[model samples]
Target: MLNKFTTKIVSLSTLNNYSFIIPTYQRPYVWGEEQIKKLLDDVLLSFTTNKESIYYISTFLTKEVGDKAELIDGQQRFTTLWLIALVLSEMTSNNSEISTFLKKGDELRLSFEIRDEIKNYLKALLKKESTSKFLNEHFIKKHPYLENIAEALSTIKGYFLQLSEDYNLNEFGNYIYTNVKLVKNTTPTNTDLNKLFTTINSAGIQLEQTDIIKARLLNLIKDEKIKFSRIWESCENMNNYFERNVRQAFPNWKSFNFKKPFDFNDNLFQHNEDVIVTNPKDIFSIDDLLEHDYETVNINTDIKSNQTEEINENEVYCRSIINFSQLLLHTYRIHLFKEGKTDFPEEFHSKNCIAIFNEMIKRNNTEEIKRFFKLLWKVRFVFDIYIIKWVTNIENKTEQLELMNINSNTDGYYSRTKYEPSSNLMLQSMLYFTGDYLRQYWLTPYLNYLLQDFDNVAPTNNSHLEYLEKMDNIISTRGGKSEKELSFEYLKTNEFTQQRLDIEYFNMHLGTGFKHYWFQKLEYILWKNWKDREEKNFKNYRITSRNSVEHIYPQNPENRIQHPEIENKHLHCFGNLVLLSVAQNSEYSNKSVSVKKSMFGEKKHTYDTLKSFYIFQSNQWTPKEIEEHKSEMINLLKMHYEKTFF
Candidate 1:
């Protein structure tokens, strides 16, 4: 019969007989703030309304009552309420009422197998640690277990803290009384509850197929009518079959998925219409699972509504890759247990284990699993390179080499050792590589070596000079240029010097560098001055390389026809020594023209300065005028510099 449950404000003492059931698979006690606030709010509201005969309750349907109440459903909510009660008990002056409540809740004891774990949980609650600490300490303390309680505890604690200021004790208690409701006398079987839990909490880490299989088998074996000893013996008998068929078939299964029992649905795995029905030849045993032909079932559920982002192709691929990688744990576990190797660590052999790790490619069939495989493979190859560089004289290309101070030899063979690496080294290498690629984008093999010592990565005052030395050596070997080399070639090169002088010094100082068309004006000015100087019979007229362009004038601009401006006839026009070096012209900077004429009389060349000056004066001064333009002169300089650089 369906039993209707209602809230009642029965004294805490009365609750002793009515135990709260939290199944083994149910999470440890976790009460975060939000849940605590909700409870407090509800209790406060109830007090304001003067509600006396009400109690917040949850209903559960289960197959058994003695021992631990096999949690069918409502584990998260129930465990959270229990924690709140404990906190309330601590707050109240009287201890008897709260003690009674706890006694009743603790009446359903955990099986002997997990008694230590149960004790640990109770101890954590009694202590004044953070809610997360309490739950994680018990549930997630080690490997292969689920911690539903931790989340619950966190939520409940956070909730209470929020309401502490606004609501008084009475009001808070009442709020909880009204809001936190649990149905009474609800009869849901363990299987039913497990199914519901799986369905509701499918988003995080869904139960694996093998977990469901194990659940069914466990449920069958747990039956009182069935002799458990015989079942165990049968399991032993069918060990080979189970391992060969079930274990081998689901090689990638993880125990985390089997935290709870199975929720069987007939429709999910329906019988086929292959009609030769024979009397059961062999009774189903845990061992004989291989011989049995059970149809597999998987449900296709929609993505949760709470998911904010639509999964992209990359995300899908990544998730798949992670899932496949996780399967190695099962394979390793099987090998360890079968070989009786109790000392073997439960961690997966990702480095050496050869599973179906596929590469993630852009083409068809490229998914997360594939990507994970490729990434792992690439990292492995890089690690191999590091090792090769380390053992051999070759320089390592990876960043790790620099850290290790290993010299780089681009061309070197990777040396092989006859001995296999120790387990610790292997594990360390795996972790280092995994973290490096996944976190840092660098897959340096040197990380494997660096991470060997815990203190190396620690933030302490220990000297890291040895490591730094190794790193420098590695950097050198790897062909990374030193700072000294960079300074010489890139910093102090001649090209840089030229660029600096041209832009910083010459361009800003004189307007001469400004215009490209000013060369003609400059030439005209020089020629006219040259002629005046020649007429005065100046000597020592020699061309200079520094300022050499052309000499067309006498000492005065007006000596020929370019310009008539004159102070002394020796006032050289800007065009006079256009082609002479600055050094050569500066030697006669303020000298008179007669001085140069006497010096030049010794050499009677037809194209001497005086003769050349007349020839320039004979030409139309328009050409000279144009040649004297500053823009043309500047252009000529610009062209020369550009050509030199180019």
Candidate 2:
């Protein structure tokens, strides 16, 4: 049956016989960061470790539809492979073979048999047009597959930026074209994919791709096999490697060896309170105004790029090491996502990278391995720098650099706003949402904003605080649906737990980080107005990890005289909550309301927030007061929504 019709191992380069088409049954392009990275890692490993001159990725099951072949089971991999090919084509401009398949647009076609709106949406992306209005106004509601396409596009472009110039990109491109092979499988006459879906679903996965990736990465180190293997295994608890000092050490990426293990005791990296320790020699080379030029001030200042690198001189080397991983999703998000939200798969994001050993015994030439590692490290470095200080890769030709003049001037925090969000406000907002507990409603829009404004060559008209406004509209107008309700509506997850909820209760149901997110956003918005008039210790008031929801009415009533207002009912509700430091919460825990107010005065710096400051106006503690405070806070939230959307 396999031989009767047609089957051939076709390299992506010389392939031109049949056009590939994605059917409507393929649904949304759901290959997320995990799937995307896994595919890239798998292919890279195959190239680096496998000895096969032609590495067959998988078989594409299809039946001919006119001149084009209707893709049945292989749509996801095909889409990803095509995107990777496009990236490589740009990387290797001189190579005609890599670009030919794509330049001849008919070779890879999108035949959305059911969802017609998506055809245009994809065309817009390919044309490099501003898809915001189409995405916002029509496609979102009209096309069900919109989210997947948007995500895939965002993920691909973001990863492409991570490819640094240290690698032989041209050669890698050639490898992708000349070596990445696929088998074309065909059945008889034209048939609806919906009818064939059951048969395709039963077909098993062909390759254990990630396992191969592990063998390849580990194979980098030939010496100190046992020691490094142990370290690699332990590190494989799986996390992205964070080499903070490599920016300084390897000013050039072409030379870093993935195989050579770094000693944890080495003074190269000094992690001080989860921050990368940088020296005078690390960041600056400026010779002008505001101490340093704009170019010298790292794109991402959240790393304390401009601040003094004052850390423990006699610091222990125990907590400073970062183990490298094949799945660099964290760094990938850092590059692409303005507010890196967590939704990536656990194994893809969490596990340690397995290095290629002998079964990994595949044979990639030294130059190929070196080049692959260069791409890997480039992705890591670009993403790390993006998260810390938004710097584009100077070596990456794909990174379109801005023509700028930085001779003497240097005071662009992108800071200093009057009422609206300045460049600093947007930048801060992006830095702000890097927590794991962000809601999907907000994550979707936030990713959209970053891809549009931050990654663009020039900022757009609606690219400022208005972007925040649009995002707020997107999130706040989750149509007052609860997480369960929204999940059911969109994701088709109709569990027994799913129920209806109003906006107020929905607010209560938000994640801890998301609650903190809003409280901090409000704090910053109000702080900008209050920054003037010389407020003591309040000038630098920004959200810290220590700032937590402080229950004014304590969770547990004291052993002493109990108050009716401080009941178990009100303890966990938003009515009793305000932002306070961990130290302050501990200090005021179970204390009388009057005593807590007195402590609040002493620790005024902690209570500098408008939300907390509003609480101080009422001296007494009663159920009525708590209810009123809750009402006021709710109004503030409403006001924030009003300001953002309208």
Q: Which one is best on TM-score? A: 2
Q: Candidate 1, residue 501: CA error in Å?
A: 66
- Give the root-mean-square deviation of each candidate in angstroms: 35.8, 25.4
lDDT by residue (1-646, candidate 2, tens digit) is 2223466677776556556777666755776654575556455545655435556677777778565677777878887777676566655664636666663453235455666566666555445576455555345545557766655554554444334323456666667778888887665563444645543453333223333554465566554333322222223322222332332232232233332222232223232343342212222211111132232222331223223332433221111112233223333333323223233322222222232222223554444433333333433322222222212333452221111111111321111102222334443443333232222233233333343345422232345445544444343356555432332233211221212213465235222222445555556555544534365555434444333456666655563465554454455556667655433454565776667777667864544456666676797766677778766666665665666442
Write candidate 1's Cα lDDT for 1-646 as tens digits.
2232222443333444455445555654444333444444444544545545354544543334543345545555555556566556555432323433444343322221343555456556655454744345334545222243433443343334334444454445434534445553333232244544444343233343323322333343323212221112212211121111111112222221221122221232222223221112222321122233334323432111121332222110001111222332322232222334331222122332332111111112323322222233222222222221112223443111111111212322111221222222222222222221111111122222222332423211123323322232232222344222322222112322222113222223221222211232223223323434443333323211121223333433323433444432122333233332222333333333444434434544432432234334333333244235323334543443443242
The reply for model 1, stretches above 4 Å from the true place, is 1-15, 27-58, 66-68, 94-99, 105-115, 124-166, 174-180, 185-646
Candidate 2, 195: how far from true, in Å? 68
Where is model 2 poorest over a 10-residue stretch in terms of lDDT?
Answer: 400-409
Candidate lDDT (C-alpha), each: 0.32, 0.45
